[model samples]
Target: MQLAIGISACLLGQKVRYDGGHKASEFCLSQLQPYVRYQAVCPENAIGLGTPRPAIRLMKKTQGDIHLVQVSDASIDHTDAMHQFTEQALPAMSALAGFIVCAKSPSCGMERVRLFNEQGHQLGKAGVGLFTRQLMQRYPWLPVEEDGRLHDPMLWENFITRIFACHDYQQLCREGFSVGALVAFHSRYKFLVMAHSPSAYRELGRLVAQAKLFEPEELKQRYLQDLMHALKQACSRKTHANVLQHLQGFFKKHLSSKERQELSSLIDRFRLGHLPLMAPITLLLHHLSRFEHPYLAAQTYLQPFPEALGLRG
Candidate 1:
């Protein structure tokens, strides 16, 4: 099934911006669109703010509260309307695997958006967008990224990995919650979690070990919260090398001295930034193909997303 992803309407090439222009993402349109279904939304427009509507800004009051108001008139507040819109929109959004938002927007920016005081004095860029803030608070596990941040290779790869993992979990839910299914899901992700966070991997292992002790619903919620939290950590080259080494150990009995040495060298080169991650991973996969181990073969770490994205490079 195509993963369902939520996106800011403007980012999806809809002309719903305050100036009636779209901030279309070429990557989203050309590369990702084929793999997933997008549910586009323009919160401002959904609240009856028409195309070419007056621009809005986040204004902080003396009471230490932020409000979305017209750029020209602070008295013209739309905070209530935006909140209502978000409340209504969140239920349907529960099924989304991820969300892509416009950066620096009063309604959609993920972080570091400009802020103003009641008198319009510039405040530091510390305020989150009202709508995006709520979206995140409601779905803490959902992978949310701003359009600009998606340009960074590591961040892009991380976000894509997360959404694919989330989609898999959603499928597990649809298949009905069972202790065996939960254990299997965690087993597939074992190496992936280790790559991101060794500590989290351990924590998740413990949770999975105790899966049957808790209610099915409780176990699902707790496992997802911890799983998503672990994946959010940045996977450094050092961490990747560690995980790769652990994976290489699986082939110790099968690989000759020359094959083992070659694999180790490739991993070292990757750790030293001389090669992309795909180099070592490709060789390991080739070895796995030659010698089948069901556990190693089932790991999602080896092929987290479609290889066509070439994200590891």
Candidate 2:
């Protein structure tokens, strides 16, 4: 899958700032690099703010109005400039399935950024960065996260998984649906959903079963929406565990006793915290692939892009 991901330029180790420093994210650049197509951007710099320029801050008026203002001179309203930069860049970012922003910058912060009163006293928590807010508003389904959150293995995996799933959904969006294809797609994401919500698997199966009643276009739209929503809602760990347990159902007819035992052991190890969920999932997918069944072979879930993100353009 050719997935586009927007990244904070500094995080990608680009020295495109006034301070001549980069806040490079090693994991994102090294680990995720192979899997996604990155479009690194720096809104402030891209908006013609020269390096060494006065820093910008979110400021609040006495009337409770908040605005991103210049720290060096309170008189400057840089909102229009930032907005224009975002608008001009929209076309470039349209293909992105997700984004990773620096945690707290006036131009890219995703949440909990500081806002100050006119007197320069810290007031309270404020909204997201100018560019990040606009991006989310435009593409509500795009998976977005802060660089700091990537340190947590679960969240990191979730973020990456969502992006790739979105890519899968994009393919599904174009080609429409098939019962077998849907099942195979679900199979690939079994462990991920299991980590979030178990009951969702049953619900997804129901959707696929009922799909025959609708036209291909209608079914495609409806099922894709449900599929993506289920994934979004199942992002919690408890929800995922539930989905994982239910996935074992698909293997009932396909696996030998020893294979099932090995997979079961892996699942138990994962549940006991002795192994990563991916360990068990790897085994399940391996066996799933061994099936000579055509439906199983057509499953995009099994090979939803390898470790390479393909972003180096």
Candidate 3:
């Protein structure tokens, strides 16, 4: 299925910035564009700003209020215009599985955009871009990423994984929401949830167990909210190691002593940061090829994204 992703038009190489220059990302253009579809937008341009026009900045007011106004003169406010654009843009963006925003932009930055006081003193990168803040508030469960953050391997993989999962979940909703479908979906994500947050795994299991108590709509909302929140927690080396060890348990009866020793050693090395995560996972996949562990083989954590993406490697 094609996953529709919202992207800052400038990052997608669209000439929509105030300077008439785009902040294009080669990785995004070359690697990611092929896997997912795009819905590029420029909030500034959406607010009737012309190319090569005046630059804007987020100005801070008393009581920590922030406003989007002209960088040269804060008297010229565009906050309401941007808000109106976001409201009008929501319907078109309702189908998007994810969003990739330009970093540190006054209109689209996801976080830490520069803030200025009324007197022109710098506050810090503590403000979220107005349009992006509204977008996220409107769709709290959508996976959002910055073009700059996509440079990091882990963050890139996590972002892609989330969007893919969100797409799948939304598709399931379109088909129908049955308790059985929810169970199957949760089953696939078992190890993934564990690797990210074990507590979430337990909580999700309990919620699924009692799924019948809530209405279908209520259950979908509650379960998806918790699931997305769990996925938001970055999976650390320790947590990854724990999940790897859990996978190792499935092959205990199938693997020889030598194979077990080799696997354990690899896991130890990965846990110690001596190797990338691809090492132990590759070995596990190799073992699964010969071994018949259906449960372990079905876990999405092992292959979250397309192998051609080579995110783990």
- In order, the Cα lDDT scores of the candidates are 0.94, 0.72, 0.90
lDDT by residue (112-197, candidate 3, tens digit) is 89999999989898889998999999888889989998898888988988888788888888888999999999999999999989
- Steric collisions counted per model: 0, 20, 0
Error of 3 at 171 (Å): 2.0
C-alpha TM-scores of all predictions? 0.98, 0.78, 0.95
- State how far residue 162 of model 2 sits from its true place (Å): 0.9
lDDT at 6, model 1: 96
- Regions of model 2 farther than 4 Å from truth: 174-195, 199-229, 233-245, 250-265, 282-313
Find the number of clashing residue pairs for candidate 3. Answer: 0
Q: List the residue pairs that clash in candidate 1.
A: none
Q: How far is candidate 1 from the true structure (C-alpha RMSD, Å)?
A: 0.9
On lDDT, the stronger of 1 and 3 is 1
Model 1: how far residue 117 lies from native, Å:
0.8
Tens digits of per-residue lDDT for model 1 on 1-313? Answer: 7799999999888999999899999879987898899999999999999999999999999999999999998899999999999999999999899999999998999999999998899898988999999999999989999999999988999999999999999899988988899999999999999999999999999999988799999999888889989998999889999999999999999999999999999999999999989999999999998998999999999999998987888
Point out the higher-scoring one by lDDT: 2 or 3.
Answer: 3
Better model by TM-score: candidate 1 vs candidate 2: 1
Q: For model 3, which pairs clash? A: none
Residue ranges of candidate 1 with Cα displaced over 4 Å: none
